[model samples]
Target: MAKTFASTGDTAEKTITFAEIGEGLYAFTAEGDPNTGVIVGDDSVMVIDAQATPVMARKVIERVRTVTDKPIRYVVLSHYHAVRVLGASAYGADEILASEATRSLIVERGKEDWESELGRFPRLFQAAESVPGLTWPTMTFPTRMTVWLGKRRVDLIHLGRGHTAGDTVAWVPDSRVMFSGDLVEYHSACYCGDAHFADWPKTLDTLAAYNPRALVPGRGDALDSPKMVADGIALTRDFLTTLYDSVSESAARGLTLKQAFDRSREVMDPKFSKFAIYEHCQPFNVARAYDEARGLDHPRIWTAERDREMWEALQG
Candidate 1:
């Protein structure tokens, strides 16, 4: 697969690319960094996800201003992650929407996650001083909801918990375009530090059932056809499977987490070495996989302290 990864500030200004993926719909992706999507309708606009901080969000706003003057009526939280949801207030959105599980996760571990992420990815959280605090969604859904911006229909579906319990994918059926949050990443690393690996593939099946003609992945460029869409989903699935299998095998041999990280890296680096944040992700991915392989179903909360401990343990 062809790939390009731009590692920079939260905005990743030089690498940011916005493409008109569907009619009146746009995808703003920053190389292999986090991305934001826009759906402009006759009456209002909906932003798929806000960036890390208000300062970062301003870049998205500036881009939106270039295309439409309509008010941003809603900010959709694809999942409850610091990088995805913290800049919400900047949108001045009437409603910030999320799934019930995401809301619960926010209450359960949002603060620690905010601290942990801020400590680890200082670059992504640029303008960290501007974050008001952990962002909470004012509105939420249990399974599915279709909201209409005038006549355009955007279906928000909670297919199943994979990356996180409350992950949601925004699908625009008429246009055959889907904005798959972190649920889909084109050629980037999957931050499975908090993922449900066993359940993730099933969720991918649900996403594939839609057969989107075009997809705005969690990161990377927007895929423009069914062939590429299938390739993207398949690649993401392979990534999850490879990480999990390597750790499960390592743990079976009674190896340490660091050992598992080393083994996994040896196997995956040749293929995934160039993926964005590949270095930062390997240790954490192995730790989560080790936990899950030992029959731990849910990912343990990650605190700033835990982040440091894990990084130190596996910083090879």
Candidate 2:
């Protein structure tokens, strides 16, 4: 298999792959691109995180058609990222769902996020021209909600914020399977443009409580077995912890952003260099961590221009 990531000039945007992680849950991952998940139950199918556009989502729908003919009843937005939720139209579900906070973020900065993400990673969008607009959830919940896949019992919850303010998960209680958005990753890079470093670990703890037997991560290969699932959760937490600590230490020492970025890489590289998206994720990771170290609660919006500016500053 190809490595999870590579920097092949601007043309390299990573590749997408559909993998079956559990009996009925699937992980659709790209080589460091945004990831999506699917849950098939007795009555209907629920897709987590529509790709960037209807054309792109059709690709996923094609994959779904191979296995089942059940109608897609729900499209779940794990968060409000442009690359993740914009393709919801293709599902044509009556009720799209998300955390109430996610709905608020969509109302607040959804357009900006669309522009920002579209600018940053164009390849993942597949059919950029086909994007209808920012996707909005029809139904919103405060924290947790449960849906029976005709009695399969999939729980959707916003336990805590890790990747974004409205991150959600699709968990099967009986099967002990979970589709963690960007909250947990196996090897693919974790995007942190709007991450909450301090609060993410506690949220992770809540996820770990279940000790899932299988997990389809936000990106990377599917993890099977309780050991692999636990490993995924632990590695993700470690990444957040290490990134935050290094950036916090740099701020405490009063380093400049560029200086802090370098410091963060120096601190995290030896152990994480082989991990997916290490290079690509480092710059944005440092920016968010630096803000949090200074006591910023929620992450600020990331503009396309800002992404380029920051990438140039750190990557140079």
TM-scores of all candidate predictions against the true structure:
0.95, 0.93
Per residue, candidate 2 scores C-alpha lDDT tens digits across 190-298 of 7787999878899899988888888878777778788898888888988888888888999999998889998878878887888876776788888988998888987
TM-score, prediction 1: 0.95
Q: lDDT values of the candidates?
A: 0.88, 0.83
lDDT of 1 at 178: 95
Error of 2 at 53 (Å): 1.4
Instruction: Find the candidate with the highest lDDT and give its number.
Output: 1
Which lDDT tens digits does candidate 1 get at residues 1-316? Answer: 2121122233334478878988888999887878999999889999998999999999999999999999999999999989999999899999999999999999999999898887777788878999998898888889999989989899999999898888999998789899999999888988888999899999999999999999988888888889999999998998999889889999999998888998998889988888877776777788888999999988899998998777776772
